[model samples]
Target chain A: MIKRLTYGLVALLLLAAGPLSHAQETHTLRLAQTWGPNTPILAETVQHMADMAETMSDGRLQIRIDPANKHKAPFGIFDLVRNGQYDMGHTASYYYKGSIPNAMFFTTVPFGMIAPEQYAWFYHGEGMELMRKVYEPFGLLSFPGGNTGNQMGGWFRKEINAVEDLDGLKMRIPGFAGEVMAELGVAVTNIPPGELYTSLERGTIDAVEWVGPALDFNMGFHQIANYYYSGWQEPGAEVQFLISQKSWEKLPPDLQEILRVAMRTAAYDMYIQSTHSSGEAWSRMKDDYPDVTHRTFPAEVIEALRAATDKRLKEVAEGDPLAQEIISSQRNYLKQVRQWTNISDKAYLDSVAGE
Target chain B: MIKRLTYGLVALLLLAAGPLSHAQETHTLRLAQTWGPNTPILAETVQHMADMAETMSDGRLQIRIDPANKHKAPFGIFDLVRNGQYDMGHTASYYYKGSIPNAMFFTTVPFGMIAPEQYAWFYHGEGMELMRKVYEPFGLLSFPGGNTGNQMGGWFRKEINAVEDLDGLKMRIPGFAGEVMAELGVAVTNIPPGELYTSLERGTIDAVEWVGPALDFNMGFHQIANYYYSGWQEPGAEVQFLISQKSWEKLPPDLQEILRVAMRTAAYDMYIQSTHSSGEAWSRMKDDYPDVTHRTFPAEVIEALRAATDKRLKEVAEGDPLAQEIISSQRNYLKQVRQWTNISDKAYLDSVAGE
Candidate 1:
């Protein structure tokens, strides 16, 4: 009887402490990213986020990431996460525009707000609420993953001095930007990333629009393209992180907050990293290819591109109430925010430009 | 005998789980901030950081914040944290320049890089290492707290069209910028924040250099001053978070990571919030105070200001080798990064300006 009583007492003590100690239960979440293995900034952001989460949770939360090469589905991350095939995914929202047409607004527009302004829209304006409305129905949660800053227009063999210069010009551009290009009488082509360099070099494509200098440095476009034009499209291209509701709900509150903060920090860090690497890469590009020059498309060309973009946006907003809501929210927010930008950073930059 | 065996088994089990379960221990840290109670963005950032730390640590780590009113030491946060009166502090690095002269560089400089470029320097370039060199000897570790974005020059009663206009002009400017103004034949005065509005209205000061529109909106300077000039000084004014080494060392690895990340996220969030609020406030200022006109100093004035700034920087870099290293690093890095900014975002903004 004494032995049994002692055993019962021990069990009761262990039970009393169990809830408090259960935080030690470890959870490992599987993540899939659209970028391939060892992709510089994008892949590094995923790793950074995972490291932060693990360290902050004392190894109780672990994230196992599979890049596009492992998953063999670069553009299918949306379905993968929504169906619970993976707990989380890092990919661009615009990639899913084929199935969800309104998704492109969240990634970027042809002539939208830049990174800081767009971030303000997301966090302090109507963006998060609209984003929630878009993702909640699918049992998925979406958050901004990273930004590429302001993307360059394209690497061109010749300067675009007029609207007529785009007439039948063979350019390898993609997404909504490509659609706007097509509207302007350009021969917009989709080339594989592997073939882009050869295509531009062999004159199969007269211009190629990759990301800005950091990623573009690897593509070797500067070696062949003498003129790099400033961009009107994809002002701030924000990639996204999507999580399955089931997986998110399974984590305890502390771990959930850890994941949220880790992802947010990683997103901001990627933008800063992009800024750093782009600076370094641009400097190297100029040193190695002294003949390369920077140009902005002429007023005529910019005007045409802007008009085409506005027309496409109008069409996109047609026949869909939620799409119209998202579009108008961003447009109104940009109008107010851009005025501030013009008065502050833009004015300051212009004033000190001669220096 | 049975009872003894049972007790031994329970003891072994508890011993095995001791390290894992020890995470249940809780710690509370006291933080002192430079802002008074209910201060808008600055105080909110402190609260946001503390909330995140608590949530992420599941109450294992709690941060109790004491604003300036509670502590009665607005500019003495560095000393407070250094003496262990407070475990942490949130204040501008430059506020302690009287005691730590080299500390001002970590905040910002006249005609320095903007927010994104400055952030690149801090995270990717030599900023963090140089910062460590500055703060390590003081037994405190510092991190970027928040940014006010690109600060405006000031609210001016009259427009400044040329360098001659600065002659004998009385301005309520502070810090190194004031030194630069004094070099340009301007009368620089420091007034209490509460007295600033009445002084400016009564022509005690011809210009009042407060922060940008967001913080400045509350001061009602727009009602008195007609011209709001773009900034030449403190382009990206970043405040800092300081923690005593003893307090930092006492926390476990997980809680430390939690604190670091919480601070980082809150810092970035504050910048975005500033952007949002500034845009909102600028719009309202224009609507309510239609006489408030935005202006940029002419080329002559800007050139003179830049020259004065460069001269001051050289003097500061004279005897201090560490200051020289930091100043040179920032100049060289800014040269490279600003070139990237010019070619990418600036060029794009200029191209689309007519729209």
Candidate 2:
């Protein structure tokens, strides 16, 4: 009889301890990223975020990442995460504009705010709410994953002094920028990444618009193109992390907060990393290829490009109310914020330019 | 006899569970910050960091913050943390230049790199190692706490049209910038924060240099001074977080990572917050005081100021080898990095200014 009583007590004790041990139970999340394996800034940001989340949660939260090669779907991350095929995805929101028209503004716009300005809009202005409105219906939550700072326009084989210079210009540009270029009489072509160098090397493409110097140096465009133009299309292109609502609701509050902060830090870190790498890469490019020249679009060309971009934006905001709302919010916020940038960083840089 | 055997088993079970429960033990760190209680941006950064650490660590790591009012040591945070009176401190490194001359470089310098560039220097360049070397002797670890972005020059009662316009100008500028202004024949004065408005109003000082619009607007300087000039000195002033070596070593790896990431995220968040607030504040200032104008020092004045700044830097670098290495590194890095900045952000901004 005493043995039976002791066994009952042991069972009760184990029950009491069950919840305590359960608190330390591990949860692993599967993540799919659009970038290929070992991609420099973009892939590293995902890994950095995962590492932070894992360490902060004391092994209770693990993130398993599958690059594009593993998933075999570079641009299909939106559908994958939204449908719960993956718990989370790292990709650019603009890539899915065809499927979800309202998604493009979250990435960037032509002649838009820079990195800091866009970050301010997201956090302090109406950007986060607008983003939530767009993604909420799909049962997904989106956060800025990383930034690529100011992108370069392209590596042009010849100078572009006038708007007429773009007439029949064969260029490897993509997305909304390509549409804008097509309006200016440029034959915008989409070439695979592997074929871009040869396309520019041969007479197949007159110009190629990759990322900035950090990603562009590897493309070897500087060796072939003399005019490396400053960017107008994507001033501060920010990629995003999309999480399924189901996966998010399953995590404890503390783990959720951990994931949120890790992603935020990783995004900012990527911007800084891009800045550092771009500086190093640009310096090397200049040293190795002295003929590579930095150019800004002439006033005439910039004006025409801006007009074309405005026209496309107007067309985008035509019927969709949510799209109109996001576009208006960004435009209004940019106007207010750019005034401050103009007086501060812009003014300071101009004053010290002679140095 | 059976009861005694059961009691022995219970004791063993409890012993086995002891380590598991201890792994969840909580640690609370005390932090002292230079800012007063409820100080915007600066104080908020400390609270943000603490909140992140606490949430990420699942209540296992807590940070107790004491502002300057509680600690009664606005300028003594470095010593407080170094001596273990406080486990951590939030303060600008330049505050302790008198005690640690090398510390000033970590904060910022005249004609130094901007925020992104400075961040790159810290993360990718030799900054972190050099910073470690400086603080290692004191048994303290330092990290970038926050940035004020590009600080505004000052609010001037009269415009500076020429290099000679600075002669005998009474200005309430502090720190290294004050020294540079003194070299330019400006009558530099340090007035209490409360007395600054009246002094500038009464012509006791011809100009007053505070932070940018976010912090400066509250001082009511715009009501008195007409010209709000862009900053030349302290271009990207970064405050710091200092931790005692003993306190850092005591934390578990998970908790340490949590603390490190929290500090980093808080730093970047502060920059974004500043950008948001500055835009808002500048807009309000302009609306409330339309006569307030934005100006840049003329090219000649900028040239002269840069010369004075360079001369002072040369003097500082002469006696100390480490200082020379740091100054030289910053100069060389700035030369290489600014080229990239000029071509990317600067060019893009200028191109789109008309829009």
Candidate 3:
């Protein structure tokens, strides 16, 4: 009789302990972000993700984020996560092109699809599968962190009416776009971002390509340049969220789903936030500086730029089968998706644009 | 000594039951959706939301969705949820305009913002606040469920060349756009969705306004109608998720967050899916039926439609203060955001449109 009572007591105890143990089982993740502490939009997105994860998990999941200043490796997020020093990372994929050349395709390509179209590619097309193929080898997982929408080509002091206008033009346009410009006979140079405003104002650089109006507003580029041209390069620049496979596997299934959904929602939210802020900033820029007119490159100049971009892409794809596969996938997907964009949003925008 | 032993036993029993009680706590909510069972992207979005909610909460919070076929109320989702017969609903807000006049603004206006732009307004600008004011009285909380990107205006047998082309034209267009068409001297009528194909094929209706290619492809419209006009009526038609205030209050904070984020992510996913499906469907349509051509209404006809839409909007906002506030907010937000759209995506699309 005593043995039976003891067995019953043990059964009750196990049942009682199950809920408390699960409820109290908290997992904390350390995240490293490329942006400095309290950076707008970018860092905000990371915090937003962490907040949702924590709240949705009811304190079961906690993410402790270390920004660039804290981590002291702004562009080294991929390495940090890969080496397991950080559980997660928020950084643009293109910044690590030197380490992994194929990483650039995940960020954005010159003459690529816009934000929604690119997102469709990522979620519904071969983007996620292709991304998984690239990152899986390194024991890392990469997801789209956020987008800056379509970037402006640059703020220029003079108009480019023809292809020749690009020749010998001293412009601070970095990355693949700069290479394209270099191929078009332009003097492409890179300058420290902190000095870009002064460089453009003092004519050290005749033109500068920064981000869209939201980030650019703080740079005060509109105050210096009168012509704000539309972009060809980085049509939808998507940053990435990198996570170590070991760290991801530590969490239970429920927490894993929570983290994934939180990151996805925060990424989409950041895109919308970028859209709102850009609109507000552009409106303020136009109001403050009426002379800052929106312009597009002439068809002749655009065609030359396109040719340069295609040539550069071909060279990048040479000899690397993975690079070639990614390039072809994006090219074909863009071709199919852009047709819908042209007939829908583009057609609607064109019909209602004059107002 | 006996009393002390009894007290110890009671305390131990309570401790044993604590975890089991909490672990067994589960809440189930019944949701009624406007779409029929297995309604492709629309129904898929609701199921996605439910699956996320269930997985993230470890089945603590469960949503049981009832499609229109089960509930027998395609347009009465709001009423069903409001009356507490259903704990949640997935339907367009505008479908209840007869009962709540201000609800239409939540879906889409005649020539308002597109998907991303509208999402920006809803999340960042005055949209959520205005929506709260409109919905608060109903004891309901509504969120954006999903979006059908920029909708196609309709399929037409003949190309619309001028304003005169619309005169006395019998078109099956519904809701606010139908009212606007009537103002343009078009004999606007409503037809059952099932009979739409035959009506158009038999020339009973000269034109028909359906959804974009994804949904339209199934209706067999493209095979019969060669002219697919870009949309003006519903730039971004967003469906809504409705919850009873009581149902929301019953959820724990964590489960509530799970539901909210799941709905949000699912909504954005649906938008992306629509984009992907539309691209696929439109491409197939073009390849299979080479005679089909994408067309935008002539500028004169577009101008006439715009005028009629504006006049109707003015009438709707004339006496109602809340309606006026919502209308003005949308207009101002659209004006501000569309400039960015024009200069960004529109300019980029135009620059890279042709092969």
Candidate 4:
């Protein structure tokens, strides 16, 4: 009878241990990313976020990531997360502008604040509140997923010396920058990523504007196009993380904080990684093909581009109160912040540029 | 007999639950910070790190922070953590230059890579490895704690047009930069932080070097000295988080990652915060003090300062192989990275400056 009692007591202790071990229940989140499997920087960011979340939660919280190939919709991340097909997503916010016009601003705008400045706006200024207001209605949360640093203005076969040079310039510049270029009389075309190299090589396109040297080197745009112009459009292009409100609400407080901090760190780390990779790639490009020269649009050409950008931005902000609010807030913030930038980093850079 | 058996079973179950529930143990680390209590961004970063650690660990891992006032060893954070008096510390590595000369390079160097570039070096390049080598002998682990963006060159009472202007210039500039200045015939003196403004105002010092606008604005330097020169010294100054090896080994793998990611996010967040606050403060300074102007030292002055800095660095690297490795790595990395910077953000900023 004593032996029988001991066996029963041991079984009871095991049962009690299960409940006591985890005061909070475990949860698993499904994350859909815009990039394909093993895409550098962007895909790495998603994985980094997942690793941090899992490790911090001690496997109590798990992230099941579905890349673009699995989801079969690279640009459908926002919709997927919002509809609960996935608990979260990693994509650029601007890709969803068809459904939400204001989403584009969060990704980047022509002549927008650079990475650090944009981050400041999002965190310390009206950016977060405004971003929340945009995403809240859709029952989705948007976060800065990662940054690609300052993108290079596409690779050009010919140098643009004057505003007139833009006329009849066949380029594969997409989104709002394409609209601005169109306003300046450039023939802006959108080509599939796979066909870009062939098109540029075959004289099907005069210029191809992809990402910076890091991502661009893989596309082989430099071999055909020698003049690499610096970027004005999407100066600080930031990708985003989108989470379903349902998924967020289901998380325990600790898991919620873990996910939040994980995404934040991943985003910042990507920016640093981009900076490192771009530096290495650009250096390699210069060494491998010294003919690939860096150029900036002349003052006249820049003036025209800026004018077109301003006109387009104003047109977009016309009847949309929320859009106007965000635009004005960003503009005002940029005005104040750029002055500081000019006196600080820019001035310092200028002073040391000669060396 | 049944009642006594039931009581004994309950006691046994409770005893089993206690050990089984915590397969991973709880640990609380004591952190000593160089900043005093409530030291704005610096103090907030420490608290932010601790909060993230506690929340992510679900109270399993905790950090108890002690500010400088409580510890009375602001400059001795290295020694404190090394001796295991504090499990961790948040302090500038350069502050302990007298004891460990290599520690200063991890912080910032004169005309070094800016925040993003420096972060890239730390994470992607040889920075972490070199830093580990420096601290491993001391039996401590160091991580990047926070960044102060690009520090500004101090406020000067008059314009500096030529190299001769620095001769006999009584300035309150400390650290390696002070050594560099002294090489250029500047009478460099270290003043207590509290006395800097009065010293500048009363002509005890010709110039006062503080942090950038965010921290410097509060010191009332803008009211007295009008010329705020751009910084070449201590660009991208990063504070460090030091963990005692003893304390580090006590935590589980999950907690270690939690602590690491927390510190990284805090460091990046601090940089963004500094950018935001500096913009706000500089704007306020302009509005409140119309006479406060921004200036850059002329090419001759910059050249002289650069030469002096080079000479000093060479001297520092002369005998120490480790120091030479670090210095060479930084110089090479800066060369490659700065080229990318010139083409991207710098070019963009220059083009868009007029607008």
Query: Which portions of model 3 miss their true places by more than 4 Å?
Result: A1-11, B1-10
| lDDT (Cα, tens digit) per residue for candidate 2, span A246-277 | 99999998899999999999999999999999
Q: Which candidate is the best by DockQ?
A: 3
For B1-355, candidate 3 gives per-residue lDDT tens digits of 5456556655787876765566558999999999988888999999999999999988888999999888898999988988989999999999999999999999999899999999999999889889889988989999999999999999999988988888999999999999999999999988999999999999999999988988999999988899999999999999999998899998878889999999999999999999999999999999999999999988888889999999999998889999999999999999999899999999999998875
Error of 1 at A295 (Å): 0.5
What's the lDDT of the predicted structure labeled candidate 2? 0.92
Clash pairs detected, candidate 3: none
Encode model 2's per-residue lDDT on B1-355: one tens digit a residue.
7778678767756765665577778999999999998999999999999998988877889999999999999999999998889999999999998999899999989888899999999998988999998999999999999999999999999999987889999999998899999999999999999999999999999999999999998899999999999989988899999999999999999999999999999999998999899999999999999999999888888888899998988887888999999998888888888888899889999998876
Measured against the true two-chain complex, the DockQ scores of the candidates, in the order shown, are 0.71, 0.71, 0.73, 0.65
Candidate 1 C-alpha RMSD relative to the actual structure: 1.2
User: What's the lDDT for candidate 1?
Assistant: 0.93
User: Candidates sorted by TM-score, descending order?
Assistant: 1, 2, 3, 4
lDDT of each: 0.93, 0.92, 0.92, 0.92
Chain A alone, TM-score per model: 0.98, 0.98, 0.96, 0.95
Q: What is the lDDT of residue B197 in candidate 2?
A: 91
| DockQ-based CAPRI category assigned to the predicted complex of candidate 4 | medium
- Check candidate 4 and list the clashing pairs: none
What lDDT is reached at residue B90 by model 1?
Answer: 98
Considering only N, C-alpha and C atoms within 3 Å, which residue pairs clash in candidate 1?
none
Model 3 residue B109 lDDT score: 94
A best-first ranking of the candidates according to their DockQ comes to 3, 2, 1, 4
Tens digit of per-residue lDDT, candidate 4, span A137-236: 9999899999999998889999999988899999999999999999999999989999999998888989989999889988888888899999999999
